[model samples]
Target: MTLAHFLHGLRCASCGTLNALWLDLIRALVECHQCGQTALTLTDTDEGRSL
Candidate 1:
């Protein structure tokens, strides 16, 4: 997805920068652009919780 489609409100664990999350659906990874940190890994249980 484009940068405009990045998920906001997420803070980078390494850099403490906010609004820097990029969700990669294929890999089920949520990463921070500012610090290159893998903040979250989407699991089957997480999918249910979001809804």
Candidate 2:
């Protein structure tokens, strides 16, 4: 859902990379391919954060 919503994907704040692929087979957090930083999740106004 996250990946589908943000079709172009989010840019990594640390390394500045665009990650648009499947986050993981079991997880939902997308990792930075360039910096290898696993720092991303889907958060709503009331739900806080999701992984």
Candidate 1 lands at a TM-score of 0.60
Instruction: Give me the candidate number with maximum lDDT.
Output: 1
Clashes of 2: 0
How do the residues 1-51 of candidate 2 rate in per-residue lDDT, one tens digit apiece?
Answer: 233333266777777667643364246566656776774666577676666
Instruction: Say which candidate scores most in TM-score.
Output: 1
lDDT score for residue 44 of model 2: 73
Q: After superposing candidate 1 on the true structure, give the runs of residues whose Cα lies further than 4 Å from its correct spot.
A: 1-5, 45-51
RMSD of 2: 6.9
In candidate 1, which residue pairs get closer than 3 Å at backbone N, Cα or C atoms, i.e. clash?
A: none
Give each prediction's root-mean-square deviation over alpha carbons.
4.9, 6.9
Give the local distance difference test score of model 2: 0.57
What do the candidate models score in CA lDDT, each in turn? 0.72, 0.57
